[model samples]
Target: MSNRRDVWITGIGLVSSLGEGPEAHMQALSSGTAPVVDATGFAPYVVHPLAPISFDAQIPKKGDQRQMEPWQRIGTYAAGLALDSAGIKGNKDILGTTDMVVAAGGGERDQSVDGAILTEIESQPNPEIFLNEQLQSNLRPTLFLAQLSNLLAGNISIVHGVTGSSRTFMGEESSGTDAVRIGWSRIAAGTSEIALVGGAYNAERRDMLLLFALKRLAMHAPWAPVLAQPRGVPTGSAGAFLVLESPEHATARGAKPIAKLSGVWSERAQRNEPGAVEAVIEALINQARGDVTEGTAILSAASGAPEPTAAEVAVLARSGLPVRSITDRVGHGLEAQMPVALAIAALAVSQGSLFAPLEGEPLEKPFTETLSRAIVTGVGHWRGEGVALVERAD
Candidate 1:
């Protein structure tokens, strides 16, 4: 097998509070404008930066939007933008012939139903029976059809007719990058020339919020954390997708290659394990290139979680690359982690500026004298760890 086949990201679609497209989002990030705001919709959790897409406010088609899950709606919205960016029409014939892969960090359907249940209980008096009955009837299908991580993939497949090959991964946060690695490997193995890869997630449910709080993945509120204690995953919903094609395929189609998805490195550092995270980053640098350690930017997976973020900071102090977490703008979601990383990396290549993490204060002391390299880490509950080290082409 060829060690590497030219895999280039020719097109990108993004849904974040900053903006809908890559350029717009990058501009917002570079300008130091925060898109975070109060959370709305059915999600009751305290959210600092609610990155809802512009489409969320618009009215959906009769019956169409009514039945669709929140994640599906986000995915559909991202899919449209991604395909349009590539100038590829979402036709059955076009999709049917191309090999495709869909993956997510989290499922959105269950959360939407959870939101519905909470809404019902709030609106009704003595809502236990009423909520149960509604859940039994209306929420069951969402549980059956929408809960699985692959539902959105099925929905996309039906919409576009992408029949060549398919697979889905829910590595929590790392799932999106894992899907990209798998797709890249497939293309390298001569399995498929083209692949549509990205991730979508919605944390818009009351139960999901409470669960995250229990797990210490997010905070209930700024005051709750500042006064009481820190807990839970930061609430967020996002959809980001990319069109990856081999050089020959893109060249034949007259598509401009945005940047080569040259290399990907993933590591899993359990709270109980030692050296797991460092080993992964070291391996990534070695595998990427013999000289990759010199002045490369790292698209980091530094979600707002304190422990993992600290772990990453320690690793960076040792590794020699400047670090940044892009999750500060869109807020962080597990499933969307890697896809979001990929999207920001794509923007870095296009905009000619390396993006930095928005959450933490810049290091008081320098990790190294030379700040040429940036590390983008994908941190979340699932162990789909990813680190991208990139250098400018001469």
Candidate 2:
């Protein structure tokens, strides 16, 4: 551990319902502006819709933009922002070898095709055979390609010219945590000099809404702070990417270290057993909290699902660090949650201050001290628990 190289977060690209890029999010956080939520668009169910983004700013090729779904475009654009922030946007020398890890969900479904298949299958003599035939004939070939979880990475390669060893993870929240963990681990171990890591989510899709709704996991009431929500997750459309580099690599390139990624710890708990989530999260937090003195607060990515959120809340309360749930403003981004939380934590640490608390949450008290470190915690709605420590790059 003593020989491990320091991992620095040199650049960050974050887009959410709050806005695009770090500046917008910083402003939103500092000002304590109300979160933008659409209760009626998805009707009864509340969601944080993504603000308007001009895809041309990052993905210049109209053809490329047209071919990608919203999630891919979001990720590709965020990746470009990160490279640009790192001053390596068009620098093929660094990008060509920069490793890439993406956390993504399955591609968007073709609703029209799905509807037609369902409609015709009921009338067929053999519904099973008809369903199979419709699946093959009705779905477009490109649609299948779009559904590949790795397409987000592929699009980034095409548009941003990353051309690195690409890897994609598909589990929901765990995927995001693992992606960051691997990127940081590689940089720290000197296995890789630089890495691009993150994910994107499209919360406006009906299929995603239906998927959560069926499980009674979609919030159907007015928006509230994540911890205060009675039940369900208020999904958000977001894209977050971070440019992680070794201290030597960053200094050699003259890239300023926004913050230091000290450590990342990930775990999956057996939720069927009582107290398992709390136990796992407590252990991960203890591991991540290395030599910290003071000015440390917690940025929690607590998805508003009742049970896990409650467990996380209880554990955080015991830790006694001032806690702010990022989901209160950005909504629960599933795979993007961990990255978004890390990005915001880095931003806070670099600026030497923590953001204001939500109006309604008593647990998220005010913190006026100079912030030198931040702990980002993620307890997935269903499975997966993780904690990451970010410290000022002094």
| lDDT leader | 2
lDDT of 2 by residue, 185-228 (tens): 99999999999999999999889999899989899867878786
CA error at residue 348 for candidate 2, angstroms:
0.8
Q: In model 1, where do residues sit more than 4 Å from their true spots?
A: 39-63, 91-93, 105-147, 223-232, 293-295, 356-360, 364-375, 389-394
The per-residue C-alpha lDDT of model 1 at residue 390 equals: 36
Q: What would the C-alpha RMSD of candidate 1 be, to one decimal place?
A: 5.0
> Taking the candidates one at a time, how many backbone clashes does each contain?
25, 0
Question: Candidate 2: what lDDT?
Answer: 0.91
